[model samples]
Target: MNRPRLAVGATLACAGLLAVGCSSPSQQAAPAEQAATVNVALSDAGCSPTPATVPSGPVTFAVTNSGSAAVTEAELQAAGKILGEKENITQGLNGTFALRLEPGTYSVYCPGGQKDTWTFTVTGTGPAAPTAAPDTNVADATTKYHDYVVSEVNLLQPATKTFTDAVRAGDMAKAEAAFGAAREHYESIEPVAESFGDLDPDIDARADDVDDPAKWTGFHRIEKALWQDRSLAGMAPIADKLDADIATLKANVATATYQPAQLANGASDLLTEVSTSKVTGEEDRYSHTDLWDFAANIAGARTAFELLMPALQAKDADLAQQTEARFVDVTQQLARFKQGDGYVDYSTVGDADRRTLANSVNALAEPLSQVAGKVV
Candidate 1:
């Protein structure tokens, strides 16, 4: 479900610029701390790296895209788990993402490129020495953020029920409307759900995210049935599966725990989601409700950042202020497309407007990426 950059090129319909409840990995390294940095290039052809092995602990992938229109993002993955990623890299832009990696080979994936994937190796040296014990601010941030994740799942079940009910009843209008609404809840807390492993994919994976067509079951599968196929027949079973999956998600998150950096990374990941998949309109391709998702992802990012505000501000007041300003910049741009509760249809969005939104997201993402480093 993580390698979505390649198949996503469509622009989003609306730009809600809403708040955050958002994904995870654990590591603690301040920006001033030294770590192994790997430079990865994403181009029209594919992903490339300097190819140096480093002892594993803390590693940052410095990503740069040159002369590539299709390649919008890059991800670092091993064992089907997304370790880290940097997204929304329009041509001529550079981005970076960090993680505490164990020694192993990882894939550098950039879709819609000539090559699309590359191998990078990390030597096992274990994680860096632990940082000082976290202060109360960190504890509060994690505790509140975990509750936020649980809240989203709570909303997701009932909202999903509304959509599933509509589908079962064959009411296309209500189903479509409910579909986007339910997704907003899901997208906002995607990072938390993602932490639960297969549940994320089972509940939200797109057609492209899976290898077997039979394995494709989630909001997207139901989406295709309603929009592309234009019928609700045989949807009841799929709806049932969705109910089960989301129920399972709720149960899993009830006991979930989080680290400080994981919250920061989850916030950043949601923005990456918007920049890469939601912006492309590829996520809700059949319905063209990309804006709804765009807004929800932002909502999640904001929620996480705000939850960590105390710790972040205490550590680096300037960084906190800068991140807040960036969020405002993105939200201001998105405000132009507002249409009552939602925004205009994605198809109606002009090319210039698309560029404006993309630029704003890129700007917001820039400062947001540094958050984990600051707080941790």
Candidate 2:
């Protein structure tokens, strides 16, 4: 039920929109470009407003879930990565996210429809060269965020090894114990993982995400064998691949570029990640260690928000204060579920508690959503 549903290798030319074309994002729209708005309707059948052509430059996709239980998200993809997207749009919700797109073709993915994908060609030349350089603070935010991602990767690479080594050694208790320890690092920097083409899925994709079950690999795959199957015999290959993939992510993240606004949007994405799947306890169905991921996702968003604080505060102090307050609200609420250094099993969370957690996420998401616009 939960996976990186947006990670079908579906991408965004400019995504992470909640403005209701229900887009999701790995990055934000270009700052100087004037945004062109487009509305796409999502239904059980498919995306309704499939535009054949869109003019070049920035676009805001307002994706509305016109009544689709299964179809809850949408994405815009280009060049093998998601630029932006808005996801978890259930039956009636609508939201927007923006992107600065260069001329070319982009894919619109509304997973769960009969015909789940659409293509739109971006016409005309792209944005004119910027007259001024970006704000210095914004530039610093990007650089710092990049470094944060690298540091998280440094932690993840070794932690994954500890987990994988336990898996291969047939030590079920050790493997299970190391699972949540390793995943929190990846969870904290998921948007960085998503920015790479198939890296996110290769490392984190669940069984539901793949067309063929045999193809499923990565953390969850090993997780299922450890918790559900109660064996480690076949996991050596999966463990090796998982470690190799994290190594690849560690290598790629050092060179990746970022926009300051993406930090805000990435925070939004992290919050959305919590609200969408993790909140439902579907993220770690087998292990029941979802709260670990829940914490990590929020922590990642919090990191981005902190990194963007300088720029965000410079632009809108009131918004910054409100955003910070909301972060506290959510953090306090989340702390209720914590036990020791980790959180309680997701299975123990009652419906009322889940609602409280989801509510906190929504409260923070509202303000976090606005951060990019003001700061960028």
For model 1, the stretches where C-alpha displacement exceeds 4 angstroms are: 1-33, 36-58, 63-83, 87-94, 100-133, 210-214
Residue-wise C-alpha lDDT for candidate 2, range 177-250, written one tens digit per residue: 89998999999988768766677888998877878788899999998998889889889999999989998887
Best by lDDT: 2
Question: Which ranges of candidate 2 are over 4 A from the true structure?
Answer: 1-33, 48-57, 122-126, 129-133
- TM-score, model 2 to reference: 0.85
Cα error, residue 181 of model 2, in Å, equals: 0.9
Q: Report the Cα lDDT for candidate 2.
A: 0.77
